[model samples]
Target: MLSDTHPAGPGAAMRSDEDFVRAQTGIAPVPFVPEVRLHMAEDAIALWETTETARGERGLPPPFWAFAWAGGVGVARYVLDHPELVAGRSVLDLAAGSGLVGIAAALRGARSVRAAEIDAYAVAAIGVNAAANGVRVDAAVEDLLDGDGGPAEVVLAGDVFYERAMAARFLPFLLRARARGAVVIVGDPGRAYLPRERFAALAAYEVPVVADLEDAALKTTTVWELAGD
Candidate 1:
């Protein structure tokens, strides 16, 4: 349990996105992917509680940007180690939490990096994190999956298969991107809903994670490419 004092309740007011994230987080290196650093929160649950009160609401989305998730770390490490995979190519980091994967791509010399996250707070966190690493990642708070892949040569998604409904929506979007010649890659720690048949493993990593956020302290994450594309 991480702790913070922001605000809560229906009457509490909202804070500026960038200021709130920056104020609540500190710059630190992700354990597995040390090549890039982010202004991350100390505790995932604490940040979520803070955000709920800060916006005067309950049931707000979790503060995923505060922590470096295992799946993101695995994909980011893969991207950093294999710069050639994205160098000089446009990339889309779907559900770009803290923009870690997108930042890795930008640092690795991608022609362009688009980090799309539906959570406004996550979007702000991505912008701050990118600046902390001295990289340019365009952060958009939109549901890009609702439509087709927009002009990206490669698509990198981290931990998007956590739930059945989310997996259903994500797999279809990824297949469409693959069909259009974009290389679609996903990093997952063997979540129950992942469509294993649709992906081929490219690399695997034992990513360190916070206990409060996962069932295990380490996540055996793997980067997989959409198969039969």
Candidate 2:
């Protein structure tokens, strides 16, 4: 498991809708649950920044992996925009961090959605977020491609290519699923390992990143659909 760094303190101030819209052009911190937001408010810890871990910081906090990027947002938008892809399909959201893509898939009318994550806190967050969205999703607490998992007609991965080691390992499992005839789709914001030609363009949208989340200075984010050939 990777290390986490959220600490307890005052709270991150809420942003106005105007500011949110403005910041939608850069990176942002998106919480998966009410409780998580409350905790972040209480601790005053920003969810997306790389900071020192606070003493006694509770469970695992949202990682960079949690938010939707241009890639994820695009794929999610495609899935939602085209309900025929999910209307009666079994879907698997691999590495479902904040569960945004998975929730989007469920909301788009998938017959069944299963969100799988390895982090304890993230798993808990997924359950809460799914409920909050009034969507039915099976939250699976396990690593990607572990066990004899059944095949899903569609698989979703968002912003998962950040780490070189992890990306190399993750590629084969995803390719294997594609070979099995699953409609594999990924959302990435040009992370280190994103191979441009692998995916066809779907859509582009600007997402928001919390002001306190990073030093990027720039706020809004760009999201894309990195799908297979």
Candidate 3:
């Protein structure tokens, strides 16, 4: 959702995370995924600045957890419409900014859902967002990319191929999962690093996004499945 270049930067290890999210955002439904509601900020830059001041820190990763990204929204739409792909399966939302995709899986009746983020604050926001959407999503501050294939049958990753280092690490992890018989899917708004040739498009959507964050009112996002070798 956010530009990978955005210099950014949470809470307790939950309560304070919720408190901070509440203090910084307003509850609203994502325009494209109205089935879910999230605490969001209107101005991405302003919110990031305020977050820095509130936490008395600088150089924090952007408040990516505060907003719904176009990619995540698109992937969620596809999953909701194609419930059979995720229903009754174990799902993992890797690099889950707000746990949108994982929540969608849960809402679609996935047997279990885990949403992972490297940021602790985002981890907390995930919990709050999951509760608001009335879905039970397990939140963890983890680097799922650091391991071999996980146990989840389906893995949903949003906008992860924007940066070279991350993309490099993420793609191989996804391949490992695919090799293990996991269904790996990704939602990307054509980020620079997406390895298009390796994935097959499943769906596309014109996702509404914050102009401040995306520099455009809408972005065409695509859901792509990693091909198994």
Instruction: Compute each candidate's TM-score over C-alphas.
Output: 0.92, 0.67, 0.92
- Per-candidate local distance difference test: 0.86, 0.56, 0.86
Model 3, 1-229: lDDT tens digits are 2223233332232566667788888888888999888888888889889878766678988988989998899999999999999999999899898888888899999999988898867887888888988989998888878674489999899889889998999999999999999999999997999999999999999999988889899999999999987
Clashing pairs in 1: 7-53, 8-53
Question: How would the candidate models be sorted by TM-score, starting from the highest?
Answer: 3, 1, 2
- Model 3 misplaced stretches (Cα beyond 4 Å): 1-13
Q: List pairs with backbone clashes in candidate 3.
A: 8-60, 8-61, 8-62, 9-60, 9-61, 9-62
Backbone clash total, candidate 2: 22
Q: For candidate 1, lDDT tens digit of each residue in 146-184?
A: 776769999999889999999889988999899888998
Evaluation by TM-score, superior candidate among 2 and 3: 3
Instruction: Indicate whether candidate 2 or candidate 3 has the larger lDDT.
Output: 3
Q: Tell me how far the alpha carbon of residue 90 in candidate 3 is from the true structure, in angstroms, after superposition.
A: 0.5
